[model samples]
Target: MKKHTYILASLLLVSGIALAQKENIKRANKLFKMKAYTQAAKTYETKERTQEVLQNLADSYYYNTSLQKAIETYRELFVKYGDSIDIEYHFRFAQALKGVKNYKEADEHLSKYYNKPVNTLEFIEANNKITPHNFKLKEIVNEGSSSDFGLSFYGENKVVFASTRNTENPSYAWNELPYLDLYTATLTNSNTLINVQPFPEAINTSLHESNAVFTKDGKTMYFNRTNSTRKKTDEARIAHIKIYKAELINGEWTNVTALPFTSNSYSTEHPALSKDEKTLYFASDMPGTFGSFDIYKVAINDDGTYGEPENLGETINTKHREQFPFISEFNVLYFSSIGHQGYGGLDVFRSNMVNGGFDKPVNLGNIINSNLDDFAYVIKEKDNVGYVSSNRTGYDRIFSFSREENPLTKYLVEGVVQDKNSKKLLPGALVEIINQSNKTIKDTVVGENGYYVFKLEPNKLYKIRGTRQAYIEQELEFLTGNYGKSHNIDINLESLVSVEERIHQNEKGELHVQLDKIYFNYNTSEITNEAAKTLDVLVDLMKKYPSMKVEIAAHTDARGSEQYNLNLSKQRAALVLEYLVNQGINKNRLKSVGYGETRPLNKCIKEGICDDEEYDINRRCEFTILK
Candidate 1:
């Protein structure tokens, strides 16, 4: 009985395989025709599936859905059979690899056919994050209007966008696009916008026109337009739109024309053009879409026309529509979408092509995106400011976003470097600025008067190394905390160490330490935000050597009453000492000292320098380590 049951089960399995085999070939062909590659791929996977069936299975799955499975099937089927075929499958298979983010391998294959442009958007974006700060956002591009969309650099001249302005319905509260057209504003050489206006004649139609990208040479333009509508044909229900391109001939734009490879029955628009005018990105609801209106890329062929569109894949697309693509000069793609998780409505996002696939798309975040509809953004290379078109305001307007480049401290570092021997200013010496990470962040040549200035955030340890060829390098460290008062700490560096003397090695050497000056504001004990930043540098060094003791001192320029100045300086030093104590430094290791008018370096008419700024030279405070 057990043997009979095993035989029966084997028969059933064999019958199922046989049934799968016969129709599998038929199903593969049917799906190939209908472009349902993913569903047909399962049947074609059986061992009994025919060569004709599996080859079609590979092509269908690969081309229609993605290249990952297509590569596998093509490699397997190609191995089984030599390359005698009715169609060129390998070329598309390579493009499929590129479509799926297997770029290096795809490039290996693409080199056999095409030379890809160098994508530098990733580098541009990386440096965008690596560099310093940004200017503040100032004003709106449009004070009124509610229909602006899509912004582009107008070829070293201005920014062009889509708007429903100054059109028919001139008295209408708003001029929305039925025949929407191109508008522009001048962009200053510094990337500022001015003298905004609209493009006339050929570029502007009575229909919807947006998604404009210019060729690098600035003579050609590719954009989207709604040609005509069809009724319920492949997701178009008398409401489908299309895309088009136009050329700037001589000094005028030619009439717009529809793009090639678009079917009459499907909805397509939102075109993104490559800098070389050879590649494009557009949105379509064509057959075999992974989700609603997936983003697709197409390459320009030898004849100067577009090839079959390749879907950008699931990485940058979601079930929601992704449109208005902007490929930065560096190949970083910026697009707006409703699909991915966002704060609300549509948000602008940027993605970089990395390792043959895309890095995760980054939400330009709250700084650029708003809860209301935000779309159509373009970034300037090597700049932190970008222009975005949105209806976030009560009306449609262009908003400029100033991106903060770095998040460092905010205190100004000002001091003088003097020669220890003659107490004369050292002119033209390089002042090297070092951050806490020990990276040489910046270097400035000292002015002819031997003064240097640097700005940093409060709460950091900075090392200032002053140098000249004939003189030994002099290094000074400072911890700037929250001191409400101004600083007048002038540093005087010494000569080259004498050969017989390892002077700096012995921390106890006389010239090893000296106080140039102490700084304070007029009658203030509260620390300024600038002082807070510089004090942090001091905190780090003192913590580096737990046994070091220091005296916090205050001095007054020779202008005030002797007794009052002494008390005021003492109170000021005590306030600073209290701050250090609160920062966890031992109180027993610190002392407060006040030196009134008695220590003025400059001899004055009445034992003081005569003028306020010079008089300010003596009113200061600082810390000196006591060995």
Candidate 2:
């Protein structure tokens, strides 16, 4: 009897396995017909369909930025296909992982395709350390509804947003769709959310009023309106979306008009004005996109009419969703993206608009991201904190964060480079500054008049450098620690072909000499002929003070081979001693010693650091009050 029971149990197990397989096959076929591969991918566990299903599933989840599922399916397919599989899939998979912000895993997979990873841990680590922000919860600008989004403060104590909270029953809803109406709320210093009222006929019209931003004077309002239906509406008759601008007349909006070219068989919303209030930026799904939603710009005519809309291009608009752009008066831009890696969901990013074009958007980072959607970000200049609507509490609500002045304060080092002999400004010279690792930290082009400035973060070492086509490079290094103050430096960047010095008497009657300028070529030991002229000056100084003995100290910025630099310094000192001897100064009066970048007067540390401009004290020759 026991044997019979065991046989029956085995039969049942086998039947269950067969049934599961059949069920999976049926479900897979059905889902394929329904184009639900993303939902059915796991069920279709067949070698034949694995690749196709994975591809389909990836596409399906991608539209929603659901990178976790997409990555899992792609990984399986990649493993099954082995080493011969196309790397494109891996690339896409890595990109999706980056969207969900699994940067480490994304990098691990992405690194396989290239010797150098573009968004490596090295890049991430470096960027994360100084990425701006000190954040806090400012206040709930909008609440009590699921659609309170895109909050823009238009007037004192007044904020506008879109909401779908049910309104009074109408003689049938406008356009047969759940209405998105424009609502306003008053803000108290205590951050209390109250006095929420819907904007009347001026801005809201039973259509969707999702986004609202204003001109600098708060005189005009630009907001989105879409008479959207639950399902696809009539192809030709579908009411299109546009950015409508209305003038604020006597505390009320009037003369609503649609901004042009932004409407062409697609939705255009999320309008933000430039700092000068001269242009408008928004997002659209029209043609010519790197991805789903690309940010676009439209210049405002001097008469207040809009010029043709232009895409923000690849800098801010990635191949992933780039929406809800916020422009500040300082030409700083803030936007939301899933393309850039963050802690999770959609994250806010920032970048400066340089030379009238937007720079690459930088991810705001972990301090602001959550597992839920974080979008519709805005930063008011007077407020210095970031505000955005989030669903962290299971409902879309306003959140805020702040850091030090303007999030992060970058330090500036200002100086000028000049010829010690002529005192003439050196224009168009190149500069190279090194850090602790003996690597170039800073490089700059000296402007006409020898003026140059470098920007850097505090608490880091720096090597400030300047150079020109014919002249040798000048290197200096310094330390900028955790202080709010800045450094003003000057470099009498003499030609590499020569050296200049100023001499004085010390307490012991030995010569105290200040070398104003000495220049060298990049990563080399060759002394240019002009350098001899400077050495002659040093020889003359020694001759004038024959009783004084001096040490020829050669220094380098925090860059290049430490040992090599030391040797180079020794060579330089020997050259100086030889020049002095040739000039009839006794050899005993000059002690040749190669400091080899040691005993740096400037506190520069690290490699390849582009920082502080005051670090020009590293390379020089000085005489102690020694006999």
Candidate 3:
């Protein structure tokens, strides 16, 4: 009886421990939902490795940029629940792998998730060639602040930035840092922040505020403000953010109010103003969003009213997060996106405004973008300076950069296309830059001035080709010098007038290539040995000018019925064309036509109207150059 009582006691102890573990898991989940990633990660570490627990743990580490731990946890989760895991987990796992520069393994998962091959290295290399500018970055020196970002210019001398430097503000649940507040400061020439002071109670609130933009006159401002309460959505409860505008009146900010387009159900943040201050750009996740967050724009009218918000569309949005939009003075859109194929996390991208709409976005390349979150890019285009925010060093830090034209892009070839003999500019000519591998890097048609330019890379072998209709193609092979060096390579295309002279015009005034008489056997369309030799000359000419097109015409005597003569001539012309194709001429460049007895060199229009010599003159083949 004592042994039985001991067993019951052991069972109760096991049950009590299991209940305690369950309670711990519940607490961890609540923290995770609250976005207290750091605290949740520690709590989850002590829980059982169920799929749900492991997924949350890995994501917690990933969100906090603790990539190594995230990678390790993700590996275990995939190995244990490979088929059951959601595809989105693969993307996060790949991002974690890439954060540590493990691109090879990360690409495997990305390829599976995207259903296509993704080579981050290739992307970087390609972007380097076209990214117009290279950046020289210097991290801004912040005093007594561990996190600060979203630096924007204010009134030419002062700068406005968001920071978590206020120790008295309530701690944020996301990172356990103080809630963000807007601060104004003087950015020193040596990249130091000085005279830093928070905005008055009008702009800086107890809740999170960030991403401020100011008007040129410094009379109007727009910034982000997180909601005081969380609203439940399809996935979880989220604290939606809104854009607020404040007017600087009588040396104090007043009339602070949320934009009408903002709502409690969705977020609208990161406001940017156009050069004319006529349009406002921001990031939002409201209805009709293509992804988690997309860049949106609304026009600011003359009376301060806003037009209907417009999404930037698929060209600038994706099925992932795109935020922190900054429109430069030149109307170029610079935004951060994780949806577009990037190094790993949010990378800065630029989209030019062409024809009054944003074009395709291009990654800013590796110098400014890291394999971690880099966002909040603001730039002054004319000044060639900018500021960007990044979390590459485990904390959000602001960086100021000076931009210069890329040296590789500076190494260019420019010249004019001219007529070789006439010394005249050959407008509408095609100028192509081909690499050593015979791949065309760039091509352009010269305008009225016959001038063209192509950007080049250093230490590369390239050939410049100039081509025009009825002209002999001119190609010059050259090697590129070092960066900042350029070449003037004028392409002088020679006209094919000499070749055209050999082409005689028929009595009908149609141009036809004059070759030696081709003789086929009597009553048969078979190509004779003598005919083959004559056709070889035409083959050689087409080969010399690859762009040349030819049409072979065969005419027969009018002795037979016209239909019979037409059929026989077509067979003869087809045979000659077949021979030319066999000799390596592109079939597309060759055409065959049977004039039959309809066209005659002499007045032999009907049977017995002329002698054998007149009939023989009509029964000959003529080659025509189509192009």
Candidate 4:
């Protein structure tokens, strides 16, 4: 009876532990569905390392920008359940790897996930050369403040931004930072902020307020404010954000009210206005959004009413986060997105309004972006200066940048391929640019006009080669030290057949230098004075076309033993090749071969078959172009 009671107790304990684990997993899933990634991750960490728990835990870290944790968790998921995992996990793992600058590892996963090659370093190098502007970023410092961002131009000499400096406010669960509040400061001529003060109680409630925009006259303002009351949505209690409009009356901001389109169920934030204050742009996760958040614009009519909000469409929004929309004075839309192909995290992108629709967005590149969240970009086109927010330094901080056009964008090399004698364009000719390392950087065929253009980088040495099937290839060496300058160089190719009448094709269709007998003394391979003159012509041709690669082949008449003739011809070919190398030609560009009596011009097979003159015809040197 005692043994049976002990067995029953053990079974009951196991059942209780299993039931508790199931309840914990259910609670964790509920939190994850509610977008409470911080709490969900903690809860999931206490559960078993099942596939579902591991995937959610990894994703929770990824969503919160905790890349190191995400990478570790993702590694575990892949190790345990790689075959059953979705392809999307590979993408996420690659992104996390990129965030830590593990480009080689990231590329391996990216290539597998996309079924195409992806090289982050190459993309970064190319993007650096093509991106329009370079930035000089300086962090805006606020004493005693731990986190601050989302700066906007308030007036002629003032700025407004959001900060989590107030310690008395409640801590946010996502990042453990205090709730945000709107603060204004004086912008000095030296780009420093001073006289920092929070807005009045009407604008600064005991809730989150941020991303404020103002009109040109400074009388109207729009900003984001979190709801003071909690509500249930999608089975989760949350405080949704909304946009608020305020009017300046009697030198004080009053009459603050929520925008009509805002609701307790969804979020509408990051307000921006057009230059004329006729259109208001903001980011929202409301119903009908393509993803977590998308940029939306609404028309502000003259009667103080708003038209229906219009989504920016699929061209600008993806099935992921797209937020912090800012419309420049030139009508270009700038926003932040995690869905686009970028270095990592949230990268800022710009899209121009073309024919009343936004075109494909272009990434802002590495200078203005980082491997962490970078959002809230605002710029003045005329001044060529801007302010952006980033969490790269472990906390959100404001940075001011003075933009300058990238020198590589304006540095170009363009040329035309032409015939040396005719002075006419040589269409379909190949042009190649090689670096100092003998690596080809770019290659293209000349168009109908025989013109080719290539963007070049500064402070580099390069060689440009032009070639055609029947023409001698030409090479030109140039340097790109003077940036923002265009170079026009014309390549002229000389035809081999036109240059010499003796340059004829043999029966084997090989072009050879059929010179007067290259007299080698009776049985010796020594070159005579007459033979030297004939070889000089070949040397001059190579000098004129530096890119020419040639092979010197020597052959003997069928007048001696096969082994003896072969040895003699090989010595003769080596002698000629040595002469060319002594005359300043690159050794790598020339090769020597001896065909001996094996490749005779006529059918002279035996020792006595051919006469002396006919045998002399077979004993000669030939130059065949190799490239």
Candidate 5:
């Protein structure tokens, strides 16, 4: 009986321990759902390495930008639960791999996740060419500063930003950093910050504060602050952030109040105001959010009340985080997104307002973006300079940049292809742009508008060629010396048949090179002197249009055996292609075809039926434009 009681006690203890672990996991999931990744990660680390626990733990690390830890945990999750894992895990795992520049491994997972090949290195290389600016980063040094971000224009020469530099503030559970406070400093010409000081207590509270935007008068300001009390939602307790408005009166900031749309259960942060101060833009994860967070805006009425908060919609928001919106004076919307395709983490993107709606967003590219969190982009269009915050160096740091137009995208050549004699748009004409190295950089068939455009690099020589079937190819050679400029070159293609009365296109669209019949040694495929002279004209035409692609076709009279004629005609056609290739035409531009006696000219059928003059018409060489 004693032995049985001891066994029962041990079983009960094991059950109790299992129940306790289950409760802990429940708590950790609540914290994670509340965006408290740091705390959730700690709790998850104490649990057994089950699939659920491991996935949540790895995700926590990824969300916190602890990429190395996330990679290791994800690897374990895959090894144990590879078949059961969701497709999204593969995407997150690939992103963690990219954060460490392991592109080869990342691509393998990305291919599986997206169900298509993804070449990260190739994308980075190409993106560098198109990215608008190269940034020279300088980390603003502030003594005793742990982390700082969200730098914005204050006055003529002053700057305002948020920082967690104070040790006296309460520690934030999100990252173990102090609660953020608004701070001001003098921005020197050298992009250095000096005389850094915190804002008045009215603006800097015991809770978090950040993302301050000021009006032109510098007297009105809008900023973000965390709610003092935590509100319980269905999942967890959350201290939601809100935007507050304050006025600088009599050298003091007063009348601090939260905006009308702010809710205790949802976050509304990263406030920005338009140039006229009539529109307010912010980020939120409220009821209508399509994802974790989205950019929103509202109209500021003349009476100081606000209209309904409007979500930026699908054009700007995706099923992932899109935040840190900054509207420029030119009405360009700049924001950060993790949902869009990027190098890795949050990448800055710009969308111009067109037709009174936001257009598609364009990634700022690799120079200003890294494989880590890069957000809080603010720019001054007039000065061609901007400020961005990034945690790429392991701590949030402010970087100043001077933007110049990308040389690769600075020059462009655009033109219309038209018939030279008719002056009418020639749709479906082939246009190609060649570089100095004689390499075709771009090739396209003109649309209904007969238009084509090629982005070019500055200080380079280029050739633009226009060609169509039965038309003599025309080329225009020019140099792009002026950067950030557009050049127009209209192309007019002349008909080859019009230029030479003997040249004609058959029903199959092949341009025949008609010449008087000359006697060739009974059966040799060698080029005779008369044929050489006739072929020289084609060589010159090919040289004039470098991008022209042509096929040399040879036909034979229906006199010899079919096999014999086919072989002889193939040799003759090859001879013509060789001649053109030897005369400086690219071999790739020339192709050879032999129709033999199968396609006879006119009604000439058999050797005995037609006279020599009639049979001679069937023996010919033709050149057809392939592109």
Candidate 6:
């Protein structure tokens, strides 16, 4: 009986220990759900490496941008639970890999998650060559603040930014930092913050406030205000953010109110005002969004009311988070996105306004964008200066940058193809840029606007050749200089009819090189003295317009056997092509064909069908411009 008692006691002790561990895991899960990643990670680190625990732990490190730990944990998770792990983990794993510049491994996982091959390295290389600007960034000095971002220009010399420097406020669950507040300061020439002061109690509430934008007059400001309380949603308890307007009247800010379109169920934050103060752009996750968040714009009416908010469309939004939009004076839309091809977490992108709509976004490249989150891009187009936020240093920090035209983008040539006489746009004209080595470097067909552009290199000589069917080719040679130089080489191509009266457009709209009749030896594919003289005129015309491509077609009379005539005509056409090639014309620019008794000038399809004059009309060579 005593022995049985001992066994029961031992079992009871084991049950109690197991129950305690279960309770601890439950608490950790609750913290994870609350976005208390730091604390949850610590708790999960002490737990067993179960699938759930490992997933949560890896996610915690990833969300915190502790990438090396995230990578290690994620790798372990896959090794232990590769079969049961969700596919979403692959995307996170890829991002973690990219965070450390392991793009090769990251692409493997990204390819699986996206179900398509991903080449991030190539994208980065190409972006570097074509991005419009190269930035020189300097980290702003904030002596005491560990996390601060979203710096915006306020009036002439002042700047406003969001900071977690308010230690008095309660800690945020996401990063355990203090709740964010709006702080204003005068920016020094050395990019240091001076006289930094938080906004009045009205604007700097206990809740998170950030991403402030002010009108040019500095009388009105729009900013983000996080909900004081969390509301239970299907996914989790979310504290939705709303855009609030604060009016500065008589030197005091008052009349603070949330925008009517903002809701407690969804977030609408990161306000940016257009130059005219007529449009208010912000980021939102409201209904009809293409992703977790999308950039939106609303018309601020003259009566101080706003029109319905409009999504920026798919060109700017993607199936993942796209936020922190900033519009410059030039009407360029600068935003951050994760869904579009990027290095890793949110990379800053720019999209120019074309035809009154935003074009496809271009990645800002690796200079200002890092593998971690970089956002809140604001710039002064005239000054070529800007401020952007990035978390590459393990904490969100603000950077001031001075930009110059990208050297790679500078050495380029652009212009329109036009008719020499009418000055009308020549659409569908082929333009080729050839290097000093006589190799065609690039080529493009002019669009409806007749515009053509090609990127070139510095200290190099290039020739721009413009050509269209039956048009006199134009070639202009230009040399590029260093330090971001661009040249406009407008090509005015002349028509063949304008230059050569012999060239005529046939009824079928084919341009024919009409030459005097040539007499050839009977049933032979040889060029006679008379034929040489006529071919010389054709060669001179081809040399004058080097871009022309011509087809040499030979026809035969129907008197000879059909097969014999076909072979003779083919040989004659080939001889014409060879003659042109020997006369310094590129062989690639000529084609030869024989239409023996198949395409007669007159209705003489068979032997003895017509007189000799009619047969002679069919037995001739024709030169037609192909391009």
lDDT of 3 at 311: 94
> Residue-wise lDDT of candidate 3 within 355-403, one digit each (tens)?
5788778788887899999999998898999899999988999999999
Cα deviation at 527, candidate 2, in Å, is: 57
Cα displacement (Å) at residue 247, model 1 = 1.2
lDDT of 2 by residue, 305-358 (tens): 778789888888877788888887666888887666554457788886555676
Q: Residue 167 lDDT in model 4?
A: 93
Model 1: worst 10 consecutive residues (lDDT sum) = 169-178
Residues 412-495 of candidate 5: C-alpha lDDT, one tens digit per residue: 889899988989898999999886657676899999999998877666678898888778778789998655689999999888
Better of 2 and 4 by lDDT: 4
- After TM-score superposition, what is the CA distance of residue 4 in candidate 2 from its true location, in Å? 39
Give the backbone clash total of model 4: 0
| Regions of candidate 5 where Cα sits further than 4 Å from its true position | 413-486, 489-627
**What is the lDDT ranking, best to worst?**
6, 3, 4, 5, 2, 1
Residue 242 displacement in candidate 4 (angstroms):
1.5
Off by over 4 Å in 4: 111-116, 189-191, 229-234, 410-627
lDDT of 1 at 60: 67
Off by over 4 Å in 1: 1-139, 169-179, 187-197, 233-237, 406-627
Instruction: Tell me how candidate 4 scores on lDDT.
Output: 0.86
Clashes of each: 44, 36, 0, 0, 0, 0
TM-score of candidate 5 relative to the true fold: 0.65
**TM-score against truth, every candidate:** 0.43, 0.53, 0.68, 0.64, 0.65, 0.68
Candidate 6 or 2, higher TM-score: 6
